[model samples]
Target: MVSFKEIKNDLPAGIVVFLVAVPLCLGIAMASGAPLFSGIIAGFVGGIVVTLISGSQLGVSGPAAGLAVIVLHAIEGLGSYEVFLSAVVLAGAFQLALGFLKAGSIGYYFPSSVIKGMLSGIGVIIILKQIPHAFGYDESYEGSLHFMEPDGKTTFSLLFDAIRYVSPAAVIISGLSLAILIFWEQILSKKGKIFQIIQGPLVVVILGIVLNLLFLNVYPEMALSANHLVELPVADSLGGFFQQFTAPDFSRVLTYEVLFLAGTLAIVASLETLLCLEATDKLDPYKRISPANRELKAQGVGNIVSGLLGGLPVTQVIVRSSANIQSGGRTKLSALIHGVLILGSVIAIPGLLNMIPLASLAAILIVVGYKLAKPALFKSMYRGGWNQFLPFVVTVLAIVFTDLLTGIGIGMVVGIFFILKNSYHVSHTMLTEKTPAGKEKYRMVLAEEVTFLNKGNIMQTLRKIPANAELEIDMSRSAVVDPDVRELIEDYKNTARSNNIKLSIKETAEDEKLEYEGMKF
Candidate 1:
């Protein structure tokens, strides 16, 4: 069903995404305390396997930074990476169950403000985390999303340290890379076919490699070391490469701890995937809505494959997905190509990949992060009023200060509070006025849908009706009236009778008039 023109557009985009994904896959693996090859395996499966099955055209799936802490802890608890991988396999099975149960609709319940906040928060975290890598401070793992470092340093403290120990060679490479990326995006990309065919990120990567090589020969003192470069596991033979693949230990599959960990991973990975799917769909220029349940199934399959191949658990990663969209990827082909590229690079050009400076990749991600958390977005959200702005700001702050799930949870709580407050106030409309004849008239209009949340307000309104007043309770507009509300209405009718007030119930055409005297509590 894909056309040649679509492939033409996707190829370049895939190259760009491939360039972006390499370091991320490597970095996330390092942060997760897993084998570097595992990250590559996950990326490959996400691209080649998941992309084929996913309904999402622009979304790209891979090992997620959001799961870094969980993976690290799971590995430590299980006492072996192989056992943790078994959990990943079971997690995939759990995700498949969720998809079949139609639980993916949970994504739709996430408030828009919270989702925007999440995007901005992740953007900020990306920029902050990349700062250390950008300045050649390789003490912390690349692709770490935590505000608190594993090495006793906070995110901000790392930035401060990075500035103090900044590498001149890294700074130069990153600076030039950033400048080229900007120029390509703003000017060269619009110039002609040559420019259009070559993506800025790919150019930046090549430049970094070439520049590092030049520095090694010409400016030896300014040359970067292996620690600052991409470190892919190089295999001397095909058998050696195959030997790198790790299989999950099925012996631990029935253990309570393993099953519990698998459930945890499933829930977290599914939530993260759903969130990324929503965010990626929003970022898609075509405005396509990916089927959420289908995405869960695709991700489930990817994780199953990844676990079998000694890879990290997979999710719909926003970072890679956003990179795909930004690079003009229009179909799943781009994702597929990127996967192929990753596999090829690991097999054929690992030494060449290792020559790439982390600084250059950091620069590219810095640009991506900046775009996601643009000042314009903040200004727009602020102007939209507190109802929207509060949740937006809360989500960003929570995400920046904590992990992605915790941040989203906090934002959801704040959003729900606002929802309940509004519901409490607007449950119904009550108006009391005197007619020209000086007769007191009280009119109460029920809300379209009434529930227990409206109970207090309804009771309060009824209690305030003056004695001897002409009261009319209208339920014609209400589609749902809670039982408690109906009981309250009946009780109030009795009270009206005792107060010598005339009370009448106005019902919809489909409703029967209530016999108030016959109604029992």
Candidate 2:
């Protein structure tokens, strides 16, 4: 059972998480072509609704960055943003089916190296993506997807634009906020338990807002624009509350294009959620296992809520989960409280939040990215084995050059390569026997599930077997053999006549061949 001590310990962390999430929720929504309010809705559902059903104690769910590309394309293809909400609802239904079918186990098949690489790759991307925004260079929106200028300008061109066009107020606020966040960790944490207990990110957010307000009032001309802060839909009364709900254009959802978009969202969202869940569990402080199937169900529920309320699809996010762990979270209550805090802040203190600078949020993400790409992470994987390193590197490179799915697919291939490479090394054996009668003997055995890769080993073993011997072959426990292995065995049998060996099968049957044929490749 979860303890109150854990809950109490998590309060400070929850507050920090809420602060970090607020801007991100809005930024991701903005990037996805959805209304800013939709991001808040997703954050709320992820924190409150998803946490209730999730098996993970620390993982926090929200609108995922990985879905940005898909969401962007979907919105454009669907003609209207409201029409895409129907796809979101259908995607949630698909995820629910995946949970019931216990498909979450698929996450376990990913190699540790590949997962680590993916995380690191994503970390680098986050840092790169946020560089412009952190400096208060708000060009082409906060979360721009296209590497090249949307209008054919290069990345260097965009950087030039930012340098020339950045607002003085935004630069000052961002610089100051980043400075405070940096110093807060170094100075405050050394003071006492209470100071250390409070997260640096939270301190930065609070200070950023205060600074914004002070700057705005004192020097209105030099102040950052209203766009810098989170834009929440503040509702003062009952009627205003109901107006927030965004209804779906269900009439257009049955179109072929809509159906394809729904399928894409369902598959990608489920995959990314499961991936985050798996990675987060590995990073858990207590080394506990989370129920992936349950996570899927919870995420499905969250997506449904988000879809109905004009929010994007939700997924378990590693950034917030790691922050939850780092911030001393002991239970899922931290996540629940964060959700409450999000709703309360938007309703009661949006004016206060509006003071926060985008750079401050970028500072938090930079730190998160560093944690995922820590030097020790690579060292640890190397010490574990090369089997892990190859896939991990492949995943990282693939993600950096391509996208999430492409990177993961490449990593999987590298992982399979290692698996087969390892298998071939220990999978076959040939023995030579000596008898008083001067009749040489040989024994050959092939491992179960032998593939073509194992042929070299099998042939090498066969070549060492003595001639003029009574040969005994073992296939009793072997399940399946590749065509290469069959060819090797048949070749050996044919050559036995010249070798003067009496070949005998220790175990063989017609049924065995049929069973082997039925086995998976």
Candidate 3:
């Protein structure tokens, strides 16, 4: 259950999140090649519907940038966007089943180091992805998360194009917007509550619109073109606005392609949502723990509503969630209010929103990205030592060079390797002594839980045990031993007599017998 406290903080935070979310929603829809209304619908459901169902106070759900490519290809393969909506509906049902089945525990397995890496990696990508837009290059769709694009343009190439064909008007607006955001956040904001209440992102957007309008009237040549400004589909009447929403094509709902794609959507959307949920909780200042199962259920319902309403799949989104936290949101009210603000704006002030420049939004995201990938964060991670640092750096690199999911998978593999290495290298302890007659004696104390991963280290220790010695294998503390490890010890025991060594096995009392794979030893 969410509390209703902190209206002062959450109100401003909600406004900030709403400002940041609008452009992203449109950009993601554009990137997916879907109707512009689809992104807005997903964002709406994620905020209004998901927030009501989710246990997380800070997590913000919406159409995700990570899903842009998958959605793009799926729409193409399904022959029509309406047909794809059926798959999304099925995917939502699948996620709902997963939630009820308690599969949300999968989120607990993500290592902290890898999670931090994902955050930093995404931060870097956000900045890189927004750079071209800041310079007025709109060829690469907004919310494009991958390095490679459908148009055969890489992130760097687009950046180069931005530099080569720079728009002076965009640069001026983005630069000034960046300055104001920094000024408000750094200097003026510390002065009074008014600064925090007004919020820099809102101020930036308004100033951005006003500046562009001034340019249009005074310096006509310097004004941004329609391509550079927001391009939401305008409607003449309330009925026309309602007409924008498309219902799913249920006739093809049972097709194999639809089912397969539905499964794909369920798995990918759920994975992304779980990952974002984990990251959001970690970022929460109060350190509140959210119920993962409940979050999955919320996301499930959000996607179902989104699909039925002709929107994209919904997931908990890190970028908007981080914005909420950074903006000082304290409860789920911020998310709910942001959804309400989204609704109000679309109905009353979309024309005002359409006047805002994309460059100003880019500046806001750049600032958010900078905070997420601060140099100090890297320094702190490096101080955590190689086990943590290696995975962190690898994840950042993989995200920048590859894509989000693949990068996370690569980072997880690296983190798991170090875990196994620790198990293999230090799975036991050995104590050396001398018997009364001066014959060497050795006691190898096994770890509480020894698996096949420790086989090599245990075997090496046995091979080095000298002849004419007394060796004791201690299993008193061991709870479970893998068959491979137990068998290796048994083989060493068999050869002890030939080596002129006496061997003894120390097990726990009969009441607490040593546990071996599938049996008691």
Candidate 4:
């Protein structure tokens, strides 16, 4: 069933995605307060295991930045990293149940405003967290998403601290890396087939290793310290490499706290995967629609394998999926190949990988972050109107100040408020007209559906009707009217008679024309 043409298209794309994923996996693991190797393991499981079962052709799964905050706290609260692994296992089981129950449709309920806000919020967090790493300040965690740092400094304050302790060597490497990345993307990448095959991030990383090595040899004083470089765990033999894999501790599986955390992870991961699935499908060149339920099932299996192998929790990451698309990945083979490459590199040349400096990776992420939170996106959202812009801005701010889940919660609330306001305003259309006889006539046209959300507006409209005026209540277009609204109409009818106002009701065949004169509740 496999074709050579497909491989030709996918292999190069896979290599590009692999290049993009390596540093992200390592950085996210560092951010989550987990062992660095666990990130690679998760990337392996996400690519090799999940891609095999996923319905999505281009969605690449890996450790997500959105989960970094939760993972950090879960590890701290659970008392050990292994216990958190147990929670991840349980979370996979939860996802499996969700898939079986066909709960993947829940993602459809989230507004586009909220989703965009989430993306922008995560982008801002990525840029803020990577600043110190970019300048070669390695005191803080590499992938942290929180504003408050473990060193008693806030995210903004850390910038000042990083400047005070700036490393000139790191600055130079990062500057050159960024320049190369920009040059490759803007000029060389468009000029030839070779540039298309060779990714800019890959070139930047390789060049960074070479430059740092040069600094070490030519100017010993400018050489970066070990802390400024990647630190992959080395294994001398195949058996020693196998020793790196860790299993989850099952002793904490029955604890209520563990179960609660597991449920939390499951809900969050599932939502994130579904959102990414929707986003990735939009970016597909063929406009392919991935099956949400199947994707959930695949993610559940991936997390189970990852947790068993001492990996962090996995989700469909938008960043990697977008990279896969941009790199011309045509199928799941690209993701699978990337995973195999990760395994091979770790096994064969981890020493070479270790030569990479954190500054180069930081430069790569800063570019990624800027793409996510581009100024044009904000301006476009603002032009869409207040109904769209309010929730978007609020979600971005909340996620920046708080955490992901909390920010989403706040955004959802704001989105709901806007929905309620629109519902109230759209319940009916009121018009006043003057006839040739100099008599005033009022017409109130009910909307297609009137629910309790329109109660206040309906009451306000009724109260504003002038006494002794002609009024017509129209419902011919309405398909459904709430019982509360019916009661309000009945009360208005009685009040109309008492106020000596002319009142008439127009109804459709679907509506009940109730005679409520002198009717008791």
Candidate 5:
């Protein structure tokens, strides 16, 4: 259904996104402690499978760096990679159920401060974890999102270790790679179409290969070992590629641990999808809005297929989506084509891809980490005052100290408490004055919509009246009032009469008797 003009625009963008995704796919997989092919499988399913059913014009889905930490621990906790795949498969089914229930809007319930903190926290972890790989001191493993290393070193100790065991060749490649990426992002990409089209990551990877080759020949001691480069499985034939695909372990499918993990994956993945879809829509020049629930279902299916094929869980990732938007993609065809390109490269040119150094990818991820936890973001959050700053800091610290879900949970608790505390202070207006005949008059004006959450303040106000006070409760402005508040009012009436306090209701809720036990209270 796409026009030729759209195709023309989308094709080049697709290529650009494909170039961008290759390294990220591999890097995220490496960071997740999963097989490199799993990341490719995720991108393939997210792009090709998800896009087909998606209502979004320019959303791109894949293995996100944000989920890398979860996958790493999930694999470790479950004790088998195949068992974890079963969790991922069930997670997709949960997402499908959520989509059917139209729970996509649940993502909006999270506060902006908390969400930003989560991203910032993840960013810090990424930079910290990638430091070892960046400097070529990757003795433990390629993937770790924790401060504590698998080999009994804390994050700071690991940094010291990295300095002690730094590889000159790795330092050179990664340093140069970071330079290229920064130059391309900040300068070259803005100068001309050619630079933008070629993409910095792709250029950096190619340069990394050329530089490594130079080091290998001209200075053997400076050369990166085979372990420092991407080690994608090179297939000799088409069938060999198929042989690499793995199936989930059904034996663990019905376990409580798998189900709980599945639920966690579903909720997190769906939330990330909703957030990315919203951002993508905003970035679209055409101002098209994607259907939230439909996108959830699409992502659900994508995860299911990916899990079935030994892929990591997938989400509508903002990085590739933004890349697509910036590159002028016009349709989902771009995403579809990008997925095709990924599959083709893995099958046909994996040898060339294998030449790309992990240090180059380390540089790319460092930039990503910096962008997420920029100093400017911290300054802005600080300026938003204690309510915002406290949650933000708590979430960031909790994530660095604990884990993603636990950090988010702690942040959410703080955010909800602050919301309720603010609500209690501002839910209504209270006035007290001496009326004629020396009687103290009190008036409580209810807010436009009052819920049970307002009970604490309301109850306090009602109980504070003295025996000689004249009180009037007004609800003329309120459209809806909770029965809990109404009952509190009814309870106050008895006390009013017994204490000889003059009490009158200017207006109760609209149909107070009817609202007490109806479809809505």
Candidate 6:
């Protein structure tokens, strides 16, 4: 059952997550080349829609940075943004099916170490990707893929370019915003009670908006354009608001291209959502487990709503989730309230939002990225052993060099190999006793799974058996008895004859050859 105490503890985190999610939601949409409103719509729906069905107490879902690449291609491949939105609607339906089928158990198969590595990897990626944006270089897309080259400029190259042609406006805003954020965390948080209640990021964001407004008023030529602001498609009245829905191109739904687009979106979005869910659960202070299936259903709903409203695909996001947890978010209400705030901002304060400089948001994201890719994360994984560290490092490298899906797939393969290795090494042992009778009474028991992997151990145990004694070989409870192990048992039976030992075999499934005179060494 849900508790009010839990909700109370989560309030602060939820607000923090809201502040972080807003800019991210906007930035990701911009990076994807989709409508900025699409990102906000995704964030709003993820918070309000997904929260209704989510099992997680503190997890906050929204437009994920990981989906930026997929969304960008999807918009292009589908040929029209409207057509692509239809595909998103269908993708949500598919996710709903996955939830109903109870496929969420797959989440449990992932090792904790691999999941941790993935979270940290995402954090590192966020920082690396946001460096140019933080420096006011907008050439490269925000939340770009690992190998993606935007406008013929590499991520690293753009950083150098930004440094060469640094915008004094961007520099001042970002620096001031970062300074305020830092000091807000260090000083104001430790000051009086009321000040501490107001988080540093919130204050920085507000101050950034005010600063930009002041710049616009005084130095209009130096001010950033409205294009840089969080643009919400607002209508003048309630009737206009009702007309804001974007209908999907249903005619294209049956086309092969649309199907392909839908499939790609479904797979990538699902992967990102699940990964974020896993990461969020790990960061949960109370260590609550989220029902993966339920999360899928909720995300599906959010996507459907977002797509219908011309929004980006939504997913459970780690940055927002972690911030939500860290800030003391307790209930889905926080997420819902965040969505309401987003809607209210779009409807009532688009101009005000435009006043906030992009660089300031970049600084916030940089901080978030650093927190995710902290040095302690590396040292902790290294100490956990190679089995843990290998997947962790590999995932990070793959993400850095490739894309999110590729990195996660590589990590999963490595994780599966570890599981198989452990499975092969498991020993199957059985103990037997003889009856206190002069007659050849025997008791038999078989190893757990007499597979080829256990052949050596089974052979050694058989060879050491005393001759000229009543012997019992048990196969009961054994799931698999390899042919080689059977051969060993046959050889043992035949060889024992020289010592006049009576051999008896007992198993749930009786094998004629291993049990009778037909037995051959």
After superposition, candidate 2 runs with Cα above 4 Å error: 1-4, 140-191, 213-222, 233-238, 383-385, 430-444, 460-473, 476-487, 499-505, 508-521
Candidate 6 lDDT over 1-521, as tens digits, reads 33455544445555566666766777788878787667888887888888877887777888877777777887887779899899998888888888888877777777777787777777777777666656666665555556556466565677688788666666777788788877776787678766656666667677667767787899987666654544456668767765665667788887888888777777778777887788887887678888898888888888888888888888887777776665556666666667777777777766566566667767777777777778998999899888888888888878767777788889888877776666555544545555576444344466576677666666666566565456667676687888887887777766777656667677666554244332223
TM-score of 6: 0.81
Leading candidate by TM-score: 3
User: Candidate 5 on 1-521: residue-level lDDT in tens?
Assistant: 32455776788778767766776787678778888889999988888999889899999999876677778889999999999999999999999988999988876787878878877887787678678778988664443445565456777787788899999888998999899888888898789978766767667778889999999899998999888887777888999999889899979788888998999889888877886777577668899979999989999899899999999999988767866876668899889889988888899999887787778777766776677788999999999998999999898888787766678779989998899888777668989999888989888899998889999999887788887678878887888889998999888777887777777776755644211111111
* Weakest lDDT window of 10 consecutive positions for candidate 4: 512-521
Give the per-residue lDDT of model 2 (tens digit) for 1-521.
Answer: 33457755688888878877887788778778788888888898999999888888889998886787788778997779889999998889888889999989989988778888888877766666666666677654544423433356644466677677777666665677667766767787788887767777777777667777787799887777867666666778757766877988889778898888888888888888888888887888888889989888888888888888888889988778877876778788888888989988887788777767886777777777777778888888888888988788778777766667778889989999998889989675677767789777666676777888888887777676556567777776588877877777777766666666567664564533221111111
Higher-lDDT candidate of 1 and 5: 1
Q: What's the residue-level lDDT of 254 in candidate 2? A: 84
Using alpha carbons, what is the TM-score of model 5? Answer: 0.83
How does each model score on lDDT?
0.89, 0.77, 0.89, 0.85, 0.81, 0.72
> Native-vs-model 5 lDDT?
0.81
- Candidate 1 per-residue C-alpha lDDT over 424-488 given as tens digits, one digit per residue, 9 for 90 to 100: 88889988899777878888999999988899998998888877677888899999999988988
User: What are the RMSD figures for all models against the true structure?
Assistant: 2.5, 5.2, 3.5, 2.9, 5.4, 5.4
lDDT of 4 by residue, 21-48 (tens): 8877887898888988899999989989
Inter-residue clash pairs, candidate 1: none
Off by over 4 Å in 4: 1-9, 326-328, 435-437, 509-521
Steric collisions counted per model: 0, 2, 0, 0, 0, 10
Error of 1 at 509 (Å): 3.3
**Cα-based TM-score, every candidate:** 0.95, 0.86, 0.96, 0.92, 0.83, 0.81
What is the lDDT for 240 in model 4?
A: 94
Better of 4 and 6 by TM-score: 4
Candidate 3 lDDT over residue span 1-521, tens digit each: 55677889899899889888988899899889899999998988898999999999999989999999899999999889999998998999999999999999999898898999999998998899889889998777877678898888898988999998778889999999999999999998999989988888888888889989999999999899988987777788899889989999988888898999999999999998999999999999999998988888888898899999999999999999999999889999999988888777887788888898989989989999998899998999999999999999998899888888989999999999999988898779999999999989888999999999999999899999988788888888899989998889777765786777778777774544232221112
Superposed Cα deviation of residue 131, candidate 3 (Å): 1.1
